[model samples]
Target: MPNRQAGISFCDGPKEREGREGRPAVNLRTLKYFVAIADAGSLTAAAEAIAIAQPALSRQMHALEEEMGVPLLQRTARGVRLTQAGVTLYEAAQRMLDEAQRVKRQLAGPSEAGESRVVLGVSPTLSRVLVPGLFERCHRTMDQMRLTVREAFTPELLDMLEKGMVDMAIITSMGASADRPLALHPLVGEPFALATPRSMKMDPIISLAALSRIPLLMTTLHRTVVERQLRPMGVHLNIHSEIDSVDAIRELVHDGDWCTLMPVSVFKEARSDAGITLTEVSGVQLNRQLMMATRIEAVPSTAVAALREIVLAELARLNRLRVFNFGKKPVKR
Candidate 1:
């Protein structure tokens, strides 16, 4: 009051200077408004789209520009055009909005009447045997639930889970190490068996040494698993064809001349003439751990929990049936 301007210099206080120099604070709602303005190309259109008064929208835009310490838009008689800084922010805002929408959808849970939607990813090999039965079981048990099954490889399925695209996955563990951010529940440890045409002359039990002599049609993706198990035993596989498709490999093996190594579950399918026969491989037990994978941060919904239980129960039942030739040993829950 004695001398108002005597002590208060323009940049005397740190807080006052900080307000002028610091970066602007932006939130999702502000970003949304900016995006609307950018898309509409004018305050009038943006205000109309957002159902806000033009004056209020203009005031908000002025405040944003002042806080940012930059001119974001160039006013025009017809409409508005974004400055360079505004263009950069617009692109970033668009991406943020897209991710926000995805997260919202994921968190929205189900719809009315306790009806839920669950997405399950399964390997192509497993999907052949599991999808139809799983679908039927899901529909029968949870009449209000909708289940979507996606068939993909282990790596692809893992990616889908991490991105929140799939709710759960049945995948084969590549090694002892488990992926972080994913919860792995071991469903079964399945041993590899020699699958040959029923007409092929082979022993009911084959040695790793004897397996090297057979012409094998195997998936190229499983070569690493095969080598890891066979190299220690000094047995080298003579792979005839490296096929990626499970159906193609099965068909090629069913030709009676080519044999393939697969999980015992693959041979359980009923066949008339060109049937497959599975023989236990002695000498070295090459086991693949089948795991139920879900995101570590995700808590399963009621429908998802029911689906998981159904899958585990079915796997246990299949194990008890000795479909994987585990000798009456049920899979550990």
Candidate 2:
């Protein structure tokens, strides 16, 4: 038997508890209120996020506290804090709420309409090149399907796909093993280029050998390529600084003060945006394979098919555009 003194009861809600009559329909709202109170460190901020009035949020919190027979939130002059009991339950409430929303979306979507929702991931590296245009094209092609996209690093996206968070991912990867459990569709190869600021106003590109004395901005790729390519050419670079972001490296290059060797996909956009130029080093070319990777197709959801088609179409369009000169002789892997 349950302890009556602990406030435990099967019918947890407002109004009549002994009978369903006059009882307000209660569910996870109480758990959500407890979460809000804990995060806001007070009732107000949490209430705002939850779109409930502060006092109402407080009331929900109080009801939840009473149901648990434990004070979930502690009030002090500074505001509110979660009690030890509240902290433990809040973590569980979060996962429950997320799964509930996931189920709700599945139920609300039409089952017979052949319209399904697909969630996919794109690496930030590719987002810069494809995002705006991809959105326009997907709408025209898959009007019935609801498409969703998320951006993260390749490793992060891979984790999401493995964890069933996303259906597929478009990314740049180097030699993902064949034994790995994934389906990879080959896309155009992303090549490398040596970009320099347009402000230099240099003549029609000369051999990379001639520009060896120039100060190239060091990016991660330089270590991968230039150390091998440049040393042999007798080029002595006064590398300006080691930076990470393609955008930042572009700024340094576009300013006419620095140069860097980078993959052409990144170089392509940075060149257009920052008014920079990339020339094949006249000796070395490096390209990373770009592709769409997915787990084995699920129960044939239309949304999944639509998303896969759109992604494939995008890859096709890029290939047709010949934007990266993938036709250039393949570099030795």
Candidate 3:
């Protein structure tokens, strides 16, 4: 079982549990030293890089190998070469060090007198519409807060949230049950729409059957969502192109007669463009839940809390304006 309070999953691997048999425990500092040496190819160089004595670096490596009961390195005239075991240990050590740094960043608090910094992850589908307003709001109201925005796909954002690389993320539902490590706060159910060239003669609300007859460009990531919702109703996607970038999809639909199916959020900024028009899907109410996800183990800083408030307020404002054709009003929780 994971340590819920600390958010650390205990490993039961034999190498991880080697200390159970009265062996000296291997520490992260030691792993860091070993990785440094492995990367530098010489203890003398590694020690200088890490600001440690060369002999001390050697001693730590010796102790680490002893703890694991394996010979990890072989001395060479030019430098040191990793043995088979050394290669394995080095890979694992590198991952551990990276994860450690990520955790440290996640747990770091604002300085005593400086501006608080917060990292927010936004899914690619919503970044274009959400980021500019979010950044402007933070700059106008929260002078003491600094924000870093990372735009990625929903799966990538979820992974970053899990690894403590991001403080909070806005992601679309993938139809999976909620994960224990994450606290999901529902924002809205954004409805899907048909994006067509402005010149195309289309109904005010296009049905799945009507969309199927048109050549379509759909996002590969969101295809699953459409499949899940429409496949059961015997509607199949007639995808002409599988593009990942929303901007690319929009450009394609704008330049050609091809139409694409996507969330109305994608067309929010481009609604005024004479090249494209958006119509809600009619036969099926295809939508995905948009939610804010934060690590369950995280203790939010003042900046993070403030940013959350700003985001929720902005989302509510957008909801009131019917900006993205959210299927229903967001319920206050």
lDDT order of candidates, top first? 3, 1, 2
* Deviation (Å) of 247 in candidate 3: 1.5
* Model 1 quality (TM-score): 0.64
In terms of lDDT, the best-performing candidate is: 3
The 10-residue segment with the lowest total lDDT in model 2: 1-10
lDDT for each residue of candidate 2 in 207-318, tens digit (9 for 90 to 100): 6656666666665544444565456656665566677566777666776777776666665552454576666655555566677878875565666666777777776776
Superposed model 3: Cα runs more than 4 Å off = 1-109, 270-272, 326-333
TM-score of each: 0.64, 0.60, 0.66
lDDT of 3 by residue, 1-333 (tens): 222222123332224333454555676777877888888999889999999988877877886666666788899998898999899989777657766766665578556777787789998888877888889999999989878888888887887778776788988886324654788898988888887887876667877777777778888878888888888889888888798898888777777667888888787663434566778787788888899988776577677689889999888877775767834335557
lDDT, residue 143, candidate 2:
74
> Candidate 2 overall Cα lDDT vs. reference?
0.65
Each candidate's clash count: 0, 0, 0
Q: Which whole-number lDDT from 0 to 100 does residue 116 have in model 3?
A: 80
Tens-digit lDDT track for model 1 on 83-186?
99789868867666755655776688667677887889898778766777788878888898788887777887887788777889999986324645888898
TM-score of 3: 0.66
| Winning candidate number (TM-score) | 3
